[model samples]
Target chain A: MFKKILFICLLPLVASAQETIYDSFVLAPGWTKLSFIPPESGTYTLPTYPKATNGNVINHKSEVKSLYQLYDNKITLLNFMYTTCTDINGCPLATAVFHKIQQKVSKDPVLSKKIRLLSLSFDPKNDTPDVLKLYATGTDKQLVDWQFLTSSSPELLDPILRGYQQRIVKEYDENGNYIGSISHILRVFLIDQEKNVRNIYSVSFLHPDLLINDIKTLLDPKTKNGTVIARSAN
Target chain B: MKKLISTLYGMLMSAFLAVALVPTQAFSDETCMSPYMAKIVGQEDYVYVWTLGQVGVGDEQDKLVTIAVNPNSPHYGNVIGHVSVGGRNEAHHSGFTDDRHYLWAATLDTSKIFIFDVHTNPNKPKLHKVITNFVKASGGIVGPHTTYALPGRMMISGLSNNQDFGGRTALVEYTNDGTYVATYHMPHDENLYGATKTGQIADGYGYDVRALPRRNVMITSSFTGWNNYMMNLGKLMGDSDAMKRFGNTVVVWDLHSRKPKKVFDVPGAPLEIRCAWGSQNNYCFTTTALTSQIWLIYEKDGEWQTESVGTIGDPAKIPLPVDISITADDKHLWVNTWNDGMTRVFDISDPHNAKEVYTKVIGDQVNMLSQSWDGKRVYFTSSLLANWDKADGPEKMPQFFKAYDYKDGELQFKFAIDFATEKLGMPHQMRFGAYSLYAKSPKDGAKVAELSK
Candidate 1:
């Protein structure tokens, strides 16, 4: 069953890779080489914008949980995505970057235990708890804690989307029949241990190396309000 | 030779058909809007004109005038609606938030920033919030000029300070919900603020702000203060002491940290800054008001540099370039010269050398220019300042909003609305609006989603 679900998930990606026209749209820098060097980790500061709001969610293990409980005392990188988003530069790009970050974090003993990754789905009707569980199959054994979550209904999901300022519009056909596709501006967020949103990343600024550096910056002891719980290897 | 000629003819016909058959995207807005804001990729439904209330015009209050521009609508080429703020406050510039849900219009004289909800009803924007304590909240930084959008906040540039009302000012940051975040002062000769001054002068003046996120660089251009801007144009020009007080520096800063990195000496009051949109394009163009020259701020050899690329009209004539708009392709730049009321187009394919290709007189005094994304539609407004505007005469209307269809390198006049005759105030800055930004169809009563709070 796991193999079958994985095959179904990887099918669209394979087809998209074969059919993509290189010049059709500009690939964001997160998918390619970064154009410039980022600033040193602790030399700069990320001022808090707003506190990350909480919502009721069902983790991949079919257990009910509060978003704040998952974010408790952990440096979190949260992204909103649907399982079937086919836009190469949209959800797939974010998931790919998160995957790369997970791989890099796994190599670092300290960072692997200090950070948490959350992928929450706004399409509750489509991505149920079981769907998220299947999607999060291989993440269980990873050193870093990666959780895939979804709500029971649109009512339960709306507040989380509103809190994050993540806007998504559902597509429909000429007859007003629902299409599975959703349109949104991709965003990834970085939350500190205290649940304050430190940074927001759009397509132009979403890179794994940049995310890792920001994570290290938040954990650096020299930073204001930052504890020296873990040190990152550069 | 005959076979080759036939083949060339066939290729030419195919190319012409390809060009003729493809539909024009028409997806652009005042091409220099904040990149973080949502864009109207289709036809814009309305143009919101931030008007400076003249003493005897209409209600004698600064108003947000909505002009229906989409040709498909019944009210096309007409003033559909308007909402007047209480009184005249010297309204100058306005911008939208990152989500494009609210329009923040700032007044230079009173330092009042008015926020209007453009998403709830794109056709008729209602006053949402007003920040009346800008001077007190920003710690004496006065005259908010540019309201630029960051990720989740608005970064505003100031023209003068409340202490001395001089050109020295700072940039203030505010959350989208109207809470003040912080204030960053510009680097001056007295306080370098850890920024490297690469030239002889650091005037610490502020007018416009733009950013290149990939390079982590945010740039600000300088203009004069309230003392000179609010003065009578004729008298101020004659006063040598006031004339010498214009800003002469442009500062580059680290975008993430909000810290100044380097300051370049770009004399003669650089008012508007338009950065190129191309992924690889790293340069921005700013035209000087006093010098009548185009200055390019670009990165070269891992260092940000400034160069005077070309001249606008004639320097001796003092064309006074006030507003500039670059095309989405970054190939052409439209520069509006206020003194001569002429708009010149420069071919800037080569960033180092910009050459003028076309020029046209827009009005008696044109101060703002906005072009569409496809370079097909151009919009112009003619009001620099409430006191600086040219008086209305029988022949020429100094305050007006004009639209033209740009095709084949010529501006075919589509329509014009004379503000004085229509009883509307002097129109200064124009921003585009569309219903689609909020997931609503253009049709009336279309199902609209609740925008994020």
Candidate 2:
């Protein structure tokens, strides 16, 4: 028992001390590395998807605008989630992942300037613009263009959901009592400057590297053909 | 007379506007985001392998093995380091978080998920924490198959539920910290339960799932869950009742609301789904293992449809196409056949119309395949499920890892690591690891760091 306790105490230390002989891969032969192209302004236009159906949305600031108005000639990562959702994989998961990506973009001016995030609540009855604003207060600290928007009512939100093919179903108990909450498959859409959906991210492929790389790809179309052509403007 | 003329003019104008709006659908153009190509630099290229060890095998445990796969690196193709979690816990698939820092690897049989710190040491991943009570946490969901990272959370697709080993399954969500979030059951059409005759498609088993955010769509394909996977494949195939147990449906979902839109029939164990990487490409491809056919799922005339475009191995012989991977350019797809260990490449330039261009037999049994970000280097592993593997014989090959270079339409085998000879156990899902190229942008740096740590 004493030995087992000691082993348990030292487990983390031993794990931390674990050594890895990772000889950083040489990008070239001479071992000297060149700086990559830092994110830069380019004439790249994100590929267009169908026009995002126009829907009335109230921003966290209590201002009303058409959903397309939020695009504003920049890339947008849009999702449908409520502020009260406690499901880690539903609204909370999307919010958390969106927050992480927002933070990532905040660090890069090129990305922050070109990309925007919009989280809309399907439960307009509960998640008022004020509630959404509270949920998004610290989310977009870098002010990396992250906003939480919601329709004034579920009736108004229906067309938007139908347009995007977003669906929601309520959950009920065996006793036939209304469960107050809902169930849904979490989804995130990548929209371009033209209001076209470029990519939709589900639970998979929603990572920062893939999302940022995709954003960079949209920013610079010349980087195609599988080479990571990162140039440092500095 | 003047009022009648005005009414006629208004009617004509409305008709003209409707026709003009109809053309916009055609001119919409293939709108897609080009895959972000990260230029590899110093310290940027390494492949992370989630290896599964066999029971009673050497070191009997699941491990995360990192390898340097860059062509220019001196240590290319060499195993850099590996961290083993004691116990042959059926570690099958793994995924990276949005930040690419934390990697969640799941064990199917034991219902456990282990988080590894891939960012700290890209090559040497340390087991950060282990969520051991997934069965209870997920409310009895079993056989966790895929671990996909969303922005701040991980979504896992389970093969079966606790109720019974039947086809019923659910998608379990959790915070990056492995806290239980909720479970979304795959919609079941109870009306079709007894109605499904033999060879007919029905929905239930959940295997691999992918999301299309732009379209607000999520798709999950069916595969046998825990109880079905552990049973003898040959015995199960012979039993008529057992044959019906295999999943035969692919479910489409609305991304925002997480509701099922449509469940299309995709017969014979559809294992993997690969959405076209090209921005304009709207269709995704999946392969049926039992039937040995390629299926295309796409939007046609505003409706989602599935068409079997091609076949790899003879369905009669059951070559079992286990995994399907598409090139970064969306020009070609690499389909791995488990029975004969052949990797077939198909031209997907026309997604709806795909043609097999190249075929290479890598080994006796190849299950999973991973390609580099640039689509130049391809890695292969041998191991599908522990019990479902081919019985021992000359054809019953040892588990191995082989890397190949695809250039000029030819697959050049670079190196092979035989786990059977080395007694390293079996190898499974493989994902590449890289450093955090993006800078930190957390509002409270200490708080974010603490959560991530």
Candidate 3:
């Protein structure tokens, strides 16, 4: 018991003596120099990429004098999409994920106050401000803080797309018939009051429970975490 | 009577015009920041950094860094700055576009984007008037990751929002203005629920989608995160391409043709590769992550000619390799480990028959790794916050960033940041953007002397 206690005390010291900087490759807890990660599943604190270097915002949505003004002090959830996107998997899942987030958050009033949702249009011409407002509210204003946004034309939104690293391009088939489609990836960003990306998730992969739990973690001030994922609001 | 009526009409028209134009002009004039281009020094210089896990959101969302070393300037060493963007909560990857003035940051959260003006004040950079964030269909948002810039001011983000079917993926596109032009969905993979209780999630997800030079070809790899994260591991809301290797599928698409050109049966869940745009513009040469092997394939005489240049994962236990990068010289390909802190460099001069040249052990396991263009020094970040979260003071953080000498396998320097010291929000995502071919190595991780209170 004494020896075990001593080992426990020194464990952190030993761990602190050495460190790993890159996850792309590393030594396992019980390994010597280098080893390959096995083809198995495990929980992890996934690493994130860097922010946009150029400091440019894509002007895909309608040119609002100040898009940020659209949601003043509200914890807004902004989504990305184009008008010609037919991929249900990309756009539909994103909307569905929000539906899931809404279902879970509606019950928790405290959590809901700081949270608002908005969808930013990838296509400006078709996705005008009117179209976005109509699309987000569903003509009923079902969602209180939800808003959809778009820019004037492609030029205004170009830098914004590059800044986000969200790929956007014209589509043409073999015969050159404009597919009239815009292809993009799908994920929802959960922003905090300070406007930091607290949590990000692929729409389809986003489990409503997971999102709810994450919001709980962010809303609560007690969670001291280097990589906090979620909490049970219930 | 006619004169009096005409004069009255003119007066009314003038009054109406005054009311209409003032408000709009006032609002527009208040803030009209524009995204400007950062003057490029060296040839084809680009920056590399760790993007926050967001499609694009706040301070940490659209943030990007590059190592700028211009001998003629006051701020010549590593330049740290960022631009704000509107999009998802997490950005996927960041790179340079259009004469190095525009920075491209892809998000893992939403498809929102921005083109920041890094050319502004280097120290405290501000974005000029940029693009507007895109609004997805009435329903949901999509995920966008890693990008490749083109000459015609084009960009591509490999995608996977697999919901109904097997990791159905798409190729999202945008105009140079940061607007959503259109989307190119991958051949419908409609199989998110290969095996699940909630058929809403797909078992597969396409990952590491990247663009290669030589016109139209783009590549993507995928894995089945459903069974691993959802079923066995219970990662309800996460990337499904975390576990397993068999799901490795590399899809190469034609940009101009916009057709599913061909799908290569990758060995494992391919991660990243160093496809240096050599003298040849027809094909891309890169390394696959999940498989721990080097794959070289190029379009020669129409058909795809392929070959495995090198091997990484030990055949005995199948140790998988993670990230790979090519030196600025385009002479060697560097491969880093995922489970172990080991790195191997291979000579890819001859794309078909590459060989491991350098090997070294650095730490327990690194989360991210970066090297100078010349490949003499390496910079990386710790996988966990333990290093920084537990510093000497009450609210202290260990050095989140570290530097090492690759040639001698020496621990040259380490940086320990203190929330109490710098008084800045704990510094995370330490990255080097653009430096000259052989930029002077940064002063090793020696502790910066604390300022006198």
Could you give the TM-score of chain B for each candidate, in order?
0.91, 0.83, 0.63
Candidate 1, residues B1-453, lDDT tens digits: the string is 436533543454344333333332223335777653455555677899999988877888999999988887778899988999999899999998877888999999999999999978888899999999999998999899999987667899999999889899999999778888788999998987778999988989999999888788899999988899999898898999999999988999988767788999999998899998776789899989999999999999889999999999889989889899988778888899998999999999998899999999988789888776556788999999977877664235578899999999999999999898888888999898877676566665433322211
Model-by-model lDDT, in order?
0.82, 0.66, 0.43
Q: What TM-score does structure 3 among the candidates reach?
A: 0.46
lDDT of 2: 0.66
Worst 10 residues of 2 chain A by lDDT: A25-34
lDDT by residue for model 2 (B1-453), tens? 436533543454344333322211111101111122122222235667788876655676788877766555567677767788888777888876554567788888887888998756565789999988888877888988877655445678888887887667878877656667667778667533212222245566798877654444667889876777778777777778777778888877654334455677888888788776443456788999888889998877656778898888789999999877876567788899988889999997777778989899888779998775555567899988777777683224578889887678888898887766655678888876543232222121211110101
lDDT of 1 at A203: 71
Q: What's the DockQ of model 3?
A: 0.01
**Superior candidate under lDDT, 1 versus 2:** 1
For candidate 3 chain B, the 10 contiguous residues with the lowest summed lDDT are B25-34
Model 2 chain B: weakest 10-residue lDDT segment is B24-33
DockQ score for candidate 2: 0.02
Q: Alpha-carbon error at B147 in model 1, in Å?
A: 1.8
How close to the true structure is residue B377 of candidate 3, measured as C-alpha lDDT?
55
Clashes of 2: 24
Best of the candidates, TM-score: 1
